[model samples]
Target: MKTRNLIYRYLAIISIALGANFANAQSFPDRPITLVVPNPPGGLVDTSARLLSEPLTRVIGQPIIVDNKPGASGNVAYQFVAKAKPDGYTLLISYSGYHVGNPSLMDKLPWDPVKDFSPVALLTVSTNVIAVHPSVPVNNLKELIAYAKANPGKLNYASQGNGSVSHIGTEIFKQNTGIDLVHVPYKGSGPAIQDVLAGQVQLFITTPPSVMQHVQSGKLKGLAVTGKSRHPGMPNVPTTAEAGLPSFQLESWVALYAPAGTPAPVIAKLTESVKKSLALPEVKERSDAAGVELRYLTPTAMDALLKKELPYWDKAIKSANIKLD
Candidate 1:
């Protein structure tokens, strides 16, 4: 009789817990939702967040705030979101460079990308563009390679940080082309681009949005874009293949994530809203204008992508011998 009574009480407790979770899911986003970005404003990650925030606010029926927390090569914001309450009010704007690339680059990360966060949706994908300062006498990729080879270590390349995609990608490019350029790692793209524009750093291989306007203004000469085809916003630039360097290609993606223990129902609702927001025409227009491709993936698909990318980045980092710690 005592065992039966204990079992009844246990079941009742579970029932109440589930009821509370369901109620929370139904009333999710009673307050504002914050999208914590790992990079400062004006970069691809932050731009992606802002691009989605407006439509997401309309769809989710609450204010969407973009909070920039830049430091330690995206570890600060990542760890911040990872430890936030799993009540679906705080989400992460995850970047592929920091997400897949960090595990291999750093000795230890404060949080696990897969374990500490729930995959919400994959937002945008962008390819890097190789931009040289106007002072560099490189018209295209072949010219840049030749110039770097002739003047080895004379040019400096700026990266978002030590283990960022720009750093690894530039290293790989050096290996492929047998050219040496000193690395100048900055805290974020804002500072890196500023130095590049000032001719303090001669080159930057980064996302198009970060340098496209400067290229258009002729302040920065775009050598090549690292994608299969040309970016619509920068149609004048040749692709890596077109510029005689097919082996050197780099792409990055951004996604949304909730804290690991967020309720599944809440995740489902957020995913639905994201899908709707991405489908909006204005969102598409803005994303194209910003040089980021709007590509949406469901939670399951995003998980699969993360699984596939982990080993790829691991190999790339190993090949480049990149270590941040």
Candidate 2:
């Protein structure tokens, strides 16, 4: 009788704890929330976070604050979000470089992209453009390849860091084109662009948002964009395929993620908000103006995307023979 009573008491305690957790999830955002962006304050990820803050705060009846924690090719912020309580109050604004590609490039990543976080939404995809300093003497992708081959190690390309998507993409480009350009890694895209503009670096395969203004102002010569089709911001820019490389399509994407084990109801609510935000005309226009395409994906859709892209990157890494020490 004593053992049976003890078992009943343990079950009762477990049931009560679960019920309270569910209740807390249901009443999520009872206070202000924080959206931690894993990049600098002025980048695309931070801009997207600010875009969602106002409307989401209105819907949740709480202020949404953005915190920028940029480092480690975004591993610093990724780990911070991973270790956060499995509550909906703290969310992560993620990038593909941080979540998917980093794991494949590095020997050991501190957090498992899929297992450590729950997908909230895949928000937007901004294509990268291959731009060079005006002195490179290359007008198009084919010409650039010929120039690179002729010049050999005379040209150096800058990426945000080692293991970044920019770096990986550039490596893949080198393999595809059979060119050997030196790789220069910067602390972040901001510095990389700065050096590229100052002509300290001669080439860069980087996102349009970071380099669009320079392209518009004729500071950097646009070669080709890494997308399937034309972008609204640079309609005349040819894609890599159109420029003779069919296998070079890349996009700088941003997504929202929460610590794993966050409640299903909370995820649903967040996904709905994302869809709604993407559909807004203001958001679409603003994002487009910034060279970003406003795209929304359900959590399931995003999960499938992650799965597909992981193998693709793995193959690219192997093909390029890229190994980070």
| C-alpha RMSD values across all candidates | 3.0, 2.6
lDDT minimum window of 10 residues, candidate 2: 316-325
Query: Which digits, one per residue and each the tens of the lDDT, describe model 2 over residues 1-325?
Result: 9999999999999999899888987887688888999888787788888877877777667888999998877789999999999888899999887677887877778999889999989887878899999989989999999998998999999998777789898987887889999999987788899999999899999988778888888999989999877777777789999989987788878989999999888888788877876777777777776667777888998889888888888888877776664
Candidate 1: where is the Cα deviation over 4 Å? 133-156, 176-179, 186-202, 217-220, 244-247
Off by over 4 Å in 2: 1-7, 194-200, 217-219, 315-325
What clash count does candidate 1 reach? 0
- Whole-model lDDT for model 2 versus the true structure? 0.86
Q: Model 2, residue 239: what's the lDDT?
A: 91
Model 1 C-alpha lDDT per residue in residues 231-270, reported as the tens digit of each score:
9878999999999998887888999999999999999999
Clashing pairs in 1: none
Q: Would you list the clashing residue pairs of candidate 2?
A: none
Deviation of model 2 at 40, angstroms: 2.4
Superposition error at 233 for model 1 (Å): 2.8
Residue 8's lDDT in candidate 1 = 100
